[model samples]
Target: MKLPKRPKQHILETASYKLFSSKIPDEWIIRDITERDYGIDCYLEMVNDDNELSGDLALIQLKSKDEIEWTNKDTFTHYGVDISTTNYWYQFPIPVFIFIGDISNQKLYFNSVHYTIKRNFDQFVKQTTFPYKFKKSDLFEGKDGVFAFKFHYYYEKYRQQFENELRFFISNLQHYKDFQQLHNNLDYHLGLEDTDQIFFESMHKNFSFLCTYFNIDNPIPKLRDIKKKSREKFGNESHYELYEHDLTEWMEEYEKLTINLIVGMKSFLNGELPYWLRINPTIYNYVNNIGDDGTLPYE
Candidate 1:
């Protein structure tokens, strides 16, 4: 009499969960879906450095294999995506990750659905079945640090409109230095000229794009005080030196703000920073406008 036995696929599925979960850092929570899973298996919610729960989440689909090839010399596929599953991925508000675990070696690999589609839109959309071929660089088991940077880099693209032109902006700032040789040398971007225009424009574009992408309800913060301080010079007009001084100071503040915000946002998704602190919204957010007296407006 043949006895009923657990299928090999079932055994591999359990092993895959164990293998993948073991690789994930303990601080991150893996929440299994309560509803029937058409595609996504679980969400990986991050735990910040303060030992607090960060509400940021990324959807994850987990798969297991007895053995997974890290490289593909032949025309074999690592995974396949069909129309129904592709549509489900597009519906997600945040990035979706697909993690395939090698149960045999207890190793893991990952692919970002968002990044993939962004780089290969035509192939992704036109194919009836998108065959995913894994490159050796797709390995994720020992590269969580790299993942932190990638998460921060691509997070904005998810919310951006199809016609968004933020990527067109470039940066090449000039500084006001005290070297005698450098002072006399004349470049077209002379005496912080590049920075004066570029910095202002960059800041404006960055803030505007951020507000539109994030759907901020309030207006951006003003540099009214900074602008006011510049006009108090001896001639009742500002010189290049004043602009240089103010720009340098503001750039330092902006640098700190950029680093801190990147840490908070990047750290939230991937838990890279050990002391990931939550940023206050008021530090970056602003009211629609202040009162005529320039005092805080009423809510």
Candidate 2:
């Protein structure tokens, strides 16, 4: 009697666990997420030398195959991902990797679900049946058979390129006099309300992008807190007076914090400052408007 073909999932899981654990025995830990019936199969956490958790996590989805045909040089077709699955993976809090294991060859390849979805959003909307493809080198690589599983490594690479673009933005903003003239021109052409709306919307978009990139919480609640405190402190003050005094001071403080953060990030990129120092809690106080001391609050 011919025996039934054994399910290859167990083999895939074992292979992934062994490959990941052997590479970073001390600094990384992988846990199987058996309870969830959704896209995620496992979660990986990074740890410091002392085995303390480093706050870096990634969700992984595994696919195993005996043979996967290469559709192009350095690329293989990945199929069966529905739109709902793509949407769910896109919203994951941590980075998500789809690892395809060639069970026969014991080779692994991977790609970022976040990037794949972003690249195909327009095509997805058109209901196109495009196969998801990724390059082989996209798999994690490192020295001595060890890999850097920290999501920050990938994020930092993106950030370096982003900073170059940001420099151009800052250079444009440095022309404050020109911007003011343009604002006046807009006010002459557009109504004051329209000008104000456009300016505020631009500011909102830039700050929203910054907050998301830096993993910072939205600052609107903190701004409301400052306004509330001001109202309590100066109960007899007129609304316009409060705006000129409290709101003006808050805006100035926020500007100083933004400048400091940009400068600090540049220094950190140049290896002049430690990563921890660059994103310290004290720096975050700029958003909270908590302290005025010039020195960093943490060692």
Candidate 3:
């Protein structure tokens, strides 16, 4: 009598589990979801060398096939998924990964659903085919037969993009004389309330981007501090007066601090120093001296 062959899905899942376990034995704990899962096959937890959980978790949707159709040199078009399924994955608080395994080639490719949503919003439309391409090596780093996934690794990989965007925005503020101009009229024509509101909104947007990029917790206090200091020096003057009096100085100072922060982060990512030591000394001192609960020391 011959035994029944294993199901295709079971074979794929087993192969994926084996690959993950073998590649990242030291840094990840893979848990198979036995029950009927909603587009998720497994949960992976970031772990330390001692097998202690690092509190970072990710949901993975696995797809395995003998071959995948490559739409182009750098892109693969996969089967379409329903909008509801995509939305469900999008709503995950933690990161979500879609892993594709080429069983014939013995290779694996993965992409982040979060990043996809950020970069390609149209892909989430109902009945749209999923495109898989960009391979982020930072998602899985291995050395000396040990592989691990860390949150900082992902952030560091994209730090340059964040820095470039921020630098461009700040540089425009420095060179554009009409940075405060809302319409064709000069800054003086704008009411104080309107000026304050516009500047605050812009600053808030930029600061929010920085905090999200760096995964900073409680960044509002720092933003408030910058605004408070500018207000104190510039006073409730005309928009032009505020710009000329102190806002310009504040922007210049902020640009410098941003550059320093990016440089320090780069160094830290390169293994020169730990994350705690990567903070700009001036900001670190300010946060420390102010005894602010918002800016907690990095863990």
Worst ten in a row by lDDT for model 1: 169-178
TM-score of each: 0.56, 0.48, 0.49
Show where candidate 1 strays beyond 4 Å. Answer: 72-76, 142-244, 248-299
Model 2, residue 272: C-alpha shift (Å) = 31
Q: Write the per-residue lDDT of candidate 1 for residues 67-172, one digit (tens) a residue.
A: 8754346222555566678678877877787777777777776777765564455555574665555554566654563465245435633445412332232111
In candidate 2, stretches whose alpha carbon ends up further than 4 angstroms from where it belongs are 1-5, 9-17, 20-25, 48-51, 127-130, 144-172, 175-299
Q: List the residue pairs that clash in candidate 2.
A: none
| lDDT string, candidate 3, 1-299, tens digits | 99999898798777866665665655567787886467888887766667777676778787766765554455675654556677888777677877777666666666677666544544444345555554324234355223323443355345556656555443443323244333223343333355555664565466556656655542244555655665676565634323333343344444444444444434333342222234334433333332122222342
Whole-model lDDT values for every prediction: 0.52, 0.53, 0.53
RMSD of 3: 15.1
**How many clashes in each candidate?**
0, 0, 0
Measured with C-alpha atoms, the lDDT of residue 184 in candidate 1 is 37
lDDT of 3: 0.53
Question: What would the per-residue lDDT of candidate 2 be over residues 1-299, giving only the tens digit for each residue?
Answer: 99888567776667765655544455577887766568787887767658898676778777767766665596887876776776677666567877776656656666766555444555555555535685666555464223433443355435545454445334434342233334432322222244443443454455445555555555543444644665676664443212334433434434554554454444433342232234343333332231233222231
As for candidate 3, its clashing pairs are: none
